[model samples]
Target: MATPILAQPDVDSGLRPVPVTNRNGVLEILRMRRDPFSFADEKRLRFGEVSGMNALGIRMVTCSGPEAANEILMNKDRAFANAPAWSYFIGPFFNRGVMLLDFDEHRHHRHILQQAFTPKVLKGYMDEMQPMIAERMTRFPTGKVLMLSEFKQLTLDVALEVFLGLELPKPEADRLNKAFIETVRAGVAFVRKPVPGGRWWKGVRSRKILEDFFYEHIPAKRAEQTPDLFSVLCHAESDDGDRFTDEDVVNHMIFVLMAAHDTSTITMSQMAYHMAKHPEWQQRAREESLALGEHLTYDDLASMEAIDLIMKESLRMCPPVPAQPRMAIKDTQVQGFFIPKGTMVVVPQMANHRRRDIFSHPDMFDPERFSADRAEDKAHRMAWMPFGGGVHKCIGLYFGQMEIKTIMHHLLRGYEWSVPADYVMPMDYSALPVPKDKLPVTMRRR
Candidate 1:
């Protein structure tokens, strides 16, 4: 037989290849799981914008900085896919979810989903969330407590009531929470199989639980015109008169629930942590909230500029979804590096947000960087993409921001919280980036 020609590596073409010291990429994966931002920064410094890694037995490229990020996320050439790559991490659990769909299908589903997130729909969601947020804030424990744990429960409750329109009994709610947690945990499992009692196994099992829950409710949701997201999704129609099938509603519900609650929990945790760390900013936000009165209208929520700044800084520091993953559906070159077809690509959101060439003090927590005077995020169109970019950008962006801001507004009005001066909450990257210790803080009435 004739010799098979091997593709030339980027290093051979004068582009820096990602320095993979480990043969199997296991060590790098572990380091990345431990501290993704640090790992990305180290690689960027050593390898520049485009670098290659042998991860999960695949040649994966990490794209950092605005230019490379825009190239991959924009995907103008239709050379990349979201589903196949994300499937490697989360596809089994979140199958056929909007984020996992690609090309025309992704656009179609997104258009349908957009009906559930229009301005009128979001205003209703905010209305539902405000009272729930206030009621939940009243129940928070005083003194030293794990705010991350509390925020997780709070956001999940908001998601349950506002998104599902279900006042499920405590036992059922707890069971559902466990299922969601397991499903999320499975996405990052190295095992990636349904071995009994394994992370992936649990995830697979949990996915069934979630599917059953949504599937059971689909008939009712389709029959009624409730204001909850689940109901809206069931009845929502695209401008072209397209609607989701039963399976589509369930799949999308599971994915949206996971995305909405888990990510909001992370954002709230970061805001709470940073507010506790910097009392001045907290006070500024609190004063802004006070000006809006105890009951918030949609207009009131919009007027909290200080809270917006702090939230922006919090998102920049710790984006809920740290990295956006993609797969090169066709061979493509990005930033002078050749990416072979079927190669995995990552738009490192966390690393990109902290690029010093883009931000003045990349490591420091400074909300003022977003001020009109500074406007550092304007340095590049993609410089501060916590919600991601391109055609597959988060569909629930406005809903999420409203949720975060509303929750923070209530927290500020009702309580004062603090952490020890030197405390640093280590983040767990098993699924989403969350406080490993659950982010404890001392809380009391304001």
Candidate 2:
């Protein structure tokens, strides 16, 4: 026999029994993890609206509509908390990094971190990055085939140079790159444990190796201030005269590396794939890039409005961080339902970005939607959240954009690329959705 559907309860009672069936037992939770997106879709269809489910002994709610998502993510004080659930996945590796902090503590750390991303800082960063980009892109086989996996390596090298101030030797960089890949794979491992022979164990080991390497170099960097992000961060101080400890610096460095490198790599690959599929857009972007002449300056970055629109559209279609999860610190009410304390709330950017009401013809890869005439994303303040929203929104968003554009500009001018005609998109829901096969492509000089 089917479990009888319950009636919606009164809001005034403070314990409103909504029509949602509680199907969130241990088994169901495990099943959901097997395929998170399909699981979310199933829940949405059955419930007639998204609601909470108890999965893995945690009260979890998967929200879909714009209003519900905005309320939970934006209303930080009353509806949700960032630290509780995020810590479970990222805490072990990152350890009190800004992404895991909330409330006043979040604000304090963000203020200091913001210094590394200022206009003057970005100009310095670009100056440091241009030659690196030129050097790395030159290594690509001019008229030969390539895969995103290979390109991802190139981007990772750029990130190391820009973010960490460490220009890894090719051999050493390759070794660390392999370890980093394994480490990222471990983040989404279903059995989240560091037992022998586990991905988590490998990831934990890789993290230690990275930390030790960065720690050893910090003293030299501090002695002679360099024009790298690590140097800037090492000496940065809070408004209250507080300074980051050695551990703080290492943890934050690891966090920034993982966050910036992986997200940019995925996003850039997606951008390239889209650009290839739509040749006209690629030509337009190339023209936009060439308009600024041979050298790309800070002002030139701001001027490439067409590239910005295309990048925005790519992110909208395929966000690197598809879902943002939060846990309730205390019992709270959302849209008339009493959410119990400790419940895990998910605001899926994938779902929000594809919302039919907010975006017309949502599935189509149309950059024009972001153009001045269309401006579809402006429908809601929280509608287009590729970088997320609210207090915990990604701090490196602008920098990431600048980096992607800079890379795209150089590549569009230097090379022409194509992928297999039947290449299908694959989603890896673990850490973030990356193409399973590393997205194969062929390239030639333009």
Candidate 3:
């Protein structure tokens, strides 16, 4: 019988190996779930300095600085791959979507996905989105407290209709929302199984329900050729004459819906929080939006500079996707350490964005950091990557920016809002970072 040979632990000087004395991985998993950022923070503090070569049971390296993140993400041979871990977490649902594909397959899918995000397409999307924004804003209760959970729901509704041309009924939306929430929760679940009553089980069920719903609509949409994301995808063809199969369309549709809705909803809620905290900024945004008038054209969206700045700053403070995970495809060296193949490399956006060396008063929310004169984000091109960088950077960046700006333009112009002085922002970093309490605030007409 041969004894299992553990790799030599490469702890840096003055740093100790994270004690894995406890047999069950439950405590570590719980820490990861309860407060992921804090867990990372603790590791950094305790390890006089930590090395990616030797971190925990996973044999992982976590990079927090801008330079290190850039190296890992921008590598040309595609030395790093997203498939390993992404397949572990999101694969069951989003299998073969652009994000999960790598190399040539990734490039091929990206080309097709790019067509749906053309400037002309986005202009049309804005046309459909404005009325939805205006209608949802009109429904907000004045002088009464409202939970941003409701706001997230409204944005999800808009995202579904605008992106997929599906107007989800209230009951169906509610059920889907629960399923989505559970699916996100399951991403970090300790016990990764489809056993009864487990998060994974619920998520598996949720994915099926969504897949079934979307799959049914593809044929009808293909026949009609409606002018929406679904219709475009069904009809879209690659340069080689390749087209998405019905399953491909369904998976991509689910991916787009989650990407567009979840991130935008969190970002909108954060923007609203900032607005409530800073009445002057909120007022300025409102004034700017009002100047653009009630009926906002695509051209009008470009002129909402102040609103853009506010949203950018809010995202800087609380990015929707706080961390990105990649896997080492071959043994590689990063930051002077040898990271073995199969190691998980985490480039945490939240941690990197908070580096004082990159931004003055990194903790403070200041949109001026992005101003032409300061251009603090230019300190390092990769320093301000909220939507990620490299070939895998968000394909929907332009569309997302347009959707968020459009929503802000309408809401700010039509309403006044405030967060209670005691309001606290609680973050859950399980999947996308979102406010734990859903950001309740009071609203009234300006």
Candidate 4:
């Protein structure tokens, strides 16, 4: 009988093997789930760029640093697939999302999705968001509050209005928000089955809430033209005449809304934390926002250089999606390592973002490192890829950035927030890196 390649326990000629200490894949998986950034950093320091483990009987290869990231993400040979790998973890919930499609199909879906995010469309989204942001800011709680929680609700509301064109009452809105939360948190469940009462179970149940709503509204959206993305997508078609089906619209909306709202929440809350820890930077950013007045335009966002720098640094320190995964569709070598077919290849985004060789004083919260004189991110094209890179890069990147900046502009003008000088955000690494405590800050009206 032929031996399975990964079970051979020997490194192929010119191909590096997983460290001998990494024999227990279950332990490795647990350690990674507990502290992914630490696990990746330790592996890179001890094993260099490429490493792997046979976790729960699956051969998983993990790579660190921008060079490894470039090879896998670039995927010039089309030798790796995004859908199969992502489907294993998040596919049941976010099935058929742009992030889950690959090759020609991915290109096709992306082409159609692009029409909904054109500069003009994005400008419309911004205009829609401005008044909503202002009205919502009027309700922001004062004094000590859980910042991550606040930001989460803020971004979700923005997503519901701008992306879905829904204006539900408080209770209905809250119900949908709860469903989305369950749906997202369920993706990282260690248990994969629909066991009753499990995370996966709840996720499956909540997915119906979102699906039924979108499916019900598709007809109306298709019949009318509105500024909201839901309406635009219904009427949007590729130049080649390809249009999204009802299923495609629902899948893309569920996935895109999750990506937009959740990532923005993490980025905004972390930026606030970074500012609290370093008030001088906060003051600098606030000054820029103040100069722009009560409400700022999307184009005006770029002129607030300090806010942009702070936002970039925050994303660098803690990207919303810390790691991206791909599976080898066929036997492939990424930077001299032989990746066998079916091996799950993982890209460690945060580990590379914090590599000392890549960013000097990588642990510090110095936004100036990204300034013109330094440009540390220029060290490598993929060094600070918070939104990722390649054709599979985030399709809503600009709109998401615009939304985050708009929210920041309002928060800066409406309130002043802080935490203890020596405090640090103790983060949860289970799904996304969120503060375990939900991040508390002493927020006061400015």
By TM-score, the candidates rank as 4, 1, 2, 3
C-alpha lDDT score of every prediction, in listed order: 0.86, 0.77, 0.76, 0.86
Error of model 3, residue 91, in angstroms:
1.8
lDDT at 246, model 3: 92
Question: How well does candidate 1 score on lDDT at residue 318?
Answer: 89
TM-score of each: 0.95, 0.92, 0.91, 0.96
Residue 195 displacement (Å), model 1:
1.0
List candidate 4 stretches off by more than 4 Å.
1-23
Off by over 4 Å in 2: 1-11, 18-41, 76-79
Off by over 4 Å in 3: 1-42, 45-57
- Model 2, poorest ten-residue lDDT window? 1-10
Task: List, residue by residue over 1-446, the lDDT tens digit for candidate 4.
Answer: 32134423235466643433435777787888787767877777667677777775467887778888899999999899999998887888888999999988999998999998999899899899999998899889998899988998898889889998888788877878888888888977777789999999999998888899899999999998889989888888888787899999999998998889889999998899998999998899888888888877878967988988998999998899988899999877878777878889888887778888888888899899989999999998889999888989999889988988898888888899999878889988788889999999999998
List the lowest-lDDT window of 10 residues for candidate 3: 14-23
Q: After superposition, how far is residue 345 of candidate 4 from its true place, in Å?
A: 0.5
C-alpha RMSD for every candidate: 3.1, 2.7, 4.1, 2.6
